[model samples]
Target: MQIGIPKEIKNNENRVAITPAGVINLVHAGQSVAVETRAGVVAGYSDQDYIDAGAIIVDAATAWGQDMVIKVKEPLASEYQYFRPGLILYTYLHLAANRPLTEALLASRVTAIGYETMIAPDGSLPLLTPMSQVAGRMAVQLGSQFLQTQYGGKGVLLGSVPGVAKCHVVIIGGGVVGLNAAKIALGMGAQVTVLDINPKILARIDDEFEGKVQTLFSDHQNLTLAVAAADLVIGAVLIPGAVAPKLVTAAMIRNMAPGSVVVDIPIDQGGIFETTTHATTFADPVYVVDGVIHYAVANIPGAVPKTATDALTAVTIPYAAKIGKLGVTDAAKADRMIFTGVNTYAGELTEQAVAESLNLPFHSLSTRL
Candidate 1:
């Protein structure tokens, strides 16, 4: 099997899909890897590193022309020209909210496998979890940064001095993102509260935090109150292959204090805040909305590509190697998780959740197969 590793072209997305070590592993698995020039440079790996690990250094077109193209982020409009029939695109393709990319993949008959949609035996999103952890932790850091007076923030310190009150951090959702956000916020001495609709998840948070963090049922009443009182609110909600629910309404935003900040971590899925109309890049990550700061950087982990790239490849390499060895058809047949990862195949929308989110017809993977 031939695999291609292309340099990520998204704004400020410095992470490469596969590291040199990952290439070594794939090579030993009877797979050939071609890495685009300078793909791993920003992530601290040089082209010589990939060469030493038995990977061919090639041009973008040559790399993308391989049997399977593994990438960090979804393909941008410019890269869509590389899409073709029988090409396997393995990446973190948030297709639910990306109608253009979804339609393009179907039209090109590309075999699209979304990393976020793959389900582990325990129903965990293995490929998406590492980035989620990075983003969640970074959300707190970004929130803290944006909370400074220089950034037009409230001028309050997160872990205030003895004479001052600590910042109040409210996190929505109790998934991987929420838990990591709470961990960072608490470590910084902020008073943390987590909200979720599932009682079981709330119970888990309660047990995990040992009462240090408050848990609330995420209803309109509780959300309204939490948002109003929050000095920093982290929206970490996710619906897997569907768009993120608009959990934070404009009224709720209006009710918050003037200098408060809200970080929407799931902005890739159309955002959880009604005020987040467009995704922001790290170049310009925040905006003032009704005197409140809204941080909607779509790829928060990209800010720490050195740490994020290694963490990501550690998990994704094994899956990519598996797919490389067996090919998409055989791999999907052998592993249910691989089947769940398929978003498009043979000119059809295979992922039901993504299809429903786009208001398009859904076809089962089995039917497409």
Candidate 2:
């Protein structure tokens, strides 16, 4: 099997799909790897490092021209030219909110596997979890930076000194992202609160935090009040393979104190805020909305590419090795979790949630196979 690692062209997306160690694993599995020159440079892996790992350095076209292409983020418009029939694309496709990319994959007849959609037997998103953890921790750090008056924030420190009021950190999900965010916020000495629609999740959070963090039911009334009083509101909601529900309305933004920061973690899937018109890049990560700062960078983990790359490759390598040893079809047939990751196969949309989200026809993977 021939695998390709292309350099990420997305704005500030420094992480590469595979590290040199990952390339060594694939090579040890008797698979050929072609890494685009400088693809792993920003992530601290050099071309010589890949060569040492038995991967051949190639140009972008050569890298994209392999049997299977693995990437960190989804392909941008320019990279669309590389899509073609019989090519296997393994990456975070987030197709529910990306109609253009979804259409392009179908039109090109590419076998698209989304890391975010792959669910293990235990109902965990294995590939997406590591990056989600990084993003979740980053949300608090970024929000704190934006909360400074110099950056148009309310001049509030996350960890207040003695005799000062601690900042309020409100997270709107109790999943992996939300839990990790709460951990960071709490460690910083800020008052943390988590809201979720699932009572079990709320209970788990309460138990895990040992009652140090406040847990609230994610109802309209509770959300409204929380948003109005929140010093930092983190939108961490996710519906898995579907567009995120817009829970924060414009009116809610208006009620937030001026300089209060709101970080939307699920911006790739259309975001949880109505004011999120477009995803921001690291170059320009925030904008003022109704006197509140909105941080909606689509690739939060990309900011720490070295850590992000290593963490991401740790989980994805096992799956990639399997896919390389056997073809995608055989590997997917052997593991149902891998099959669940298949978003597009043979020119048809195979993921039901993505098809429904895009208003396209859904074809089950079983039928497609």
Candidate 3:
């Protein structure tokens, strides 16, 4: 089997799909690996590192021309020309939000596997968890930075002074991202409140925080009030393969304090705030909307490339190896979880949620196989 590692070309996406150590593992498995020159450079892995691990250093075209291509983020428009029939693209394909990319994949007949949609038997997103943890933690850190008056914020300190009241932080969705955000916010001595649709998740959050953090049922009334009163609002909502539900409206943003900041971690999945027109890059991360600031960088973990690359490759290597050893279809036939990751298979939209979201016809994986 031949595997390719392409340099991530997304804005400020420094993390590569696989590390040098990951290349060593694939090489040990008797698989041929091709890495684009400088693909891992920004992630702290030198080209010699990959070469030493038995990977061929090649140009972008040669790397993308392999049987299977693993990448950190989805391919941008310029990279679309590399797509070909029967090529396997294993990456985070947020298809519900990017109709053009989805169409390109279908037209090229590429087998697109989305890391975020892959679910383990225990109903956990194994590949997506590590990056989610990074993003969740960074959400608070970035939100805090944007809350300063220098960054057009209200100058409310997150931790606050001994005599001043702590900042109020509201987090929407009590999932992995929300939980980590809450943990960091609470650690910083901020008043934290988390809202979610699942009562069990909220209960778990309540138990974990032990009354230090407030848990509320996520509803229109509660969400509106929470956002309005919050010094920082973290939109951490997710719907797996579907687009994120827009819970915060423009009116809600207008009602928030003039300097309040809203960080939408699920911007890759179409964002949880209605004001999120497009994803912002780290170069220009925030935008003002009705006097409220929005931090919706699609790739938050990319800010810490080394940590993110390590975290991503740790979980993705095994799956990538499996797909390399046995072809994508064969691997999918063996593991339903892997099958669940297939968004588009041989020109068919196999993921129902993505198809429904895009108003396309859905074809089950079993039928396609």
Candidate 4:
């Protein structure tokens, strides 16, 4: 099987689908690996590195025409035409808020697997975890930086002096992003409270933090109170194939302190905060809303491409090798764990959530497979 790694063309998305070592692994598994010229450039991997790993260097046109085309982000409108029947296009297809991409995949009849939805047998996101870790840590740092007076913030420091109190951070969803934000805020000696709908996840947070960070059952009332008092609010809720439940209202932002920040990390699935329209960039992260700042960089992990690239490829490569060796049909059957987001089969939206999102008829991939 021939696998292609296309250079990520998403704005500010510097991370590639696979790495040099990943190519070597695929090659050793008796699969052909093709790396688009400079695919790993921003990730600090030279073209020579991929070539050294036994991957053939190719141009965009040829790479897109391979048996399997793995990408880091959802393809743009122009790239949608690259999809064809029997082609495996694996990437982060955040199709809930995205209608065009879903339509294209359906029209092209490509067998698509979403990296973010590829859950492990244990119900954990092996592929998405690395990005969650990076984005979570970045939320705090970005929030802190954006809080500067120059950046139109309150000019308060995250870590305070002897008598001064540290800023408060209210993190929604005590999953990976919330926990990571809590860790960073704790390290900075700031007050942190994490809110989540799942009591089990809240319990896990309580145990992990050992009473350092506050874990509360997420509710509108509790969330409003926390947001009003917080200097920074991180929106990290996720509902697999559904639009992100709006946890923070626009009116809620008005209640918050002036210059307080809201980082909506789940902007891809329609953000948890009402103010989030679409993804923002690291270049200009903050936008004033009712005297509060909003840091909604949907692709926060891309800011640190090198780290995100390495972490993502660590888990992605092994699976890529499996898909490359077994082919999409056999790979989907053999690798149950990696088949979480099978949106289309021979020519159907097999995933119910994706079908519902696009208002298309649902067809289970099981029958087709």
Candidate 5:
């Protein structure tokens, strides 16, 4: 089987789908790997590295002609037109919130396997967790930097000294993103409060931090109070491949203190706040929605390409190689977990979550398996 690795086309997304080591392993396993020119350059892997690993360098279309195509983000509008009937486009197709992209996949009849929707036996997102961790950590750094008056944030230091008040940060959701945000906020000496609907999450965090950070029961009233008092608000929530619940509303943002900072990580999935819409580039990642500073960079980890590329490759390589060797149909038939974006087997929504999210009829993969 031939596996294609394409350079990410998403704005400021420098991470590649695979690494030189990954290429080497796939080749050793009797699979052909094709990489586009400069695909791994931003990730610090030279084209020569892929060549040395026995991968053939090719253009985008030629690479996509392979049995399986691995990528970081969804294809652009133009690339969607290139989608053939039988090609397996394995990537992070965040389609639940992307109506247009989802429509294109269904029309093209491509066997799409979303990286973010791949769940392990433990019900954790194995492939998406690394990227979430990077995004989570960067959310704090970005929020902290943007909070300075110079960067358009309140003139408050995260770690306050004598005769100064500490920055108060309110983070929604206690999943991977929220936890990582809390770590950075606490490390910076800010007053951190993480709210979540799950008591299990709160209990675990309480035990982990030993009262270092506040864990609050998630409710509209508590959230409103927290946001009103917060110097920075980080929106980090996930509903699998579906759109994130709108936990933070425009009215809530209007009630916040002026000059307060908000970083909405779920903006890619339509956001957990009413104010945010997806931004195209890192150059202008925010807009004043409801008069609050919104930092809704969907590819938040793209800011640190070197670290993100290495981490992303670590989690996706094994799975990519498995599907590459076994073929998409066989892999999907064998392990149901690998069949996330089967929106159209021969042009039908094989995944129920995707169908419901997109308002399309759901068809079971078992019917065709």
Candidate 6:
């Protein structure tokens, strides 16, 4: 099997899909690996590292021209020309957010597999979890940085000084991202509150934090109150492969205090806030909407490439190997999780959530196979 690792061309997306160690593993399994030159440079691995690991250093075209292409982010517009029928694209394809990319994949007749949609038997997103943790943790750090007066914030410090009241941090969705944000916010001595639709998750958060952080049921009334009073709001809501629900509406943003910050972590899957227009790059990460600051960097983990690349490759390598050993079609048929990851195949949308989100016709992978 021939596998290609293309350099991520997204804005500030430094993490590569495969590390040198990952290449070594694939080579050991009798698979041919081609890595684009400097793909792993930003991730702290030099070209010699890949060469030492038995990977061919090639140009972008040669790398993309492989049987299977593994990448960190989805293919950008420039790379669309490289798409061809029967090529396997394994990456985080947030199709619900990008209609153009979705159309391109279908038109090209490529077998597209989304990492975020792949669900294990236990209903966990194995490939997306590690990056989610990194994004979740970074959300707080970025949110805090934007809250300073220098950044057009209300000038409230997240961790208050002696005799000063701490900033109130409100986090929507008590999932991995929310919890990690809460952990960091608490560590900074800020008053934290987490809201979620799931009572069980809220209860678990309560137990985990030992009543240090407030937990509330996520509803219109509660969300309205929390947003209005919060100094920083972290929108971490997620609905698997579907677009994130707009819990924070324009009205909510309007009512919030002037200069309050919002960090929408699920921006890749169409953000949780109504005002979240498009993804901003790390070069220019935030924008002002109705007097409120928004930090919606689509690839938050990319800011820490070394940690993110290793963490991402650690989990993705096994699945990539499986797909390489057995062709994409056979791998999808063999593993239910892999099948779930198939967003588009043979010019049809295989994921129901993505199709419904985009108003496209949905086709079952079984039928396509």
Candidates in order have lDDT scores of: 0.93, 0.94, 0.94, 0.85, 0.83, 0.93
How much does candidate 3 score in TM-score? 0.99
Candidate 1 structure quality by residue, lDDT tens digits, 8-59: 9999999999888899999999999999999999899999999999999999
lDDT, candidate 3, at 331: 96
lDDT of 5: 0.83
Query: lDDT, candidate 1, residue 324?
Result: 88
The TM-scores of all predictions, comma-separated, are 0.99, 0.99, 0.99, 0.97, 0.97, 0.99
Model 5: colliding residue pairs: 147-153, 344-348
Better of 1 and 4 by lDDT: 1
**Candidate 6, backbone clash total:** 0
Q: Judged by lDDT against the true structure, how good is candidate 3?
A: 0.94
Off by over 4 Å in 6: none
Sliding window of 10 residues with minimal summed lDDT for model 4:
337-346
lDDT per residue, candidate 3, 1-369, as tens digits? 899999999899999999989999888888999999999988999999998999999999999999999999999999999999999999999999999999999999999999999999989999999999999999999999999999999998999989899999999999999999999999998999999999999999999999789999999999999999999999999888999899999989989989899999999999999998889999999999988999989999999999999999999988888998888989999987899999999898999889988999899999877
lDDT of 5 at 166: 90
| lDDT by residue (tens digit), candidate 4, 1-369 | 888989988778889888888888888999998889998998999999998999989999889999999888888888987888889888888887888888788888888888877777888888888888888888999888878888888999998778998899889988788888889988888889999989999989889989888888898899889999999999888777767888899988899989888899999888998887777776676678899988877788888889998898898888878888777777888887656757667777777776776687888877877
Note the clash tally of each candidate: 0, 0, 0, 0, 2, 0
Candidate 1: residue 162 Cα off by (Å)? 0.6
**Can you give the lDDT of residue 355 in candidate 2?**
88
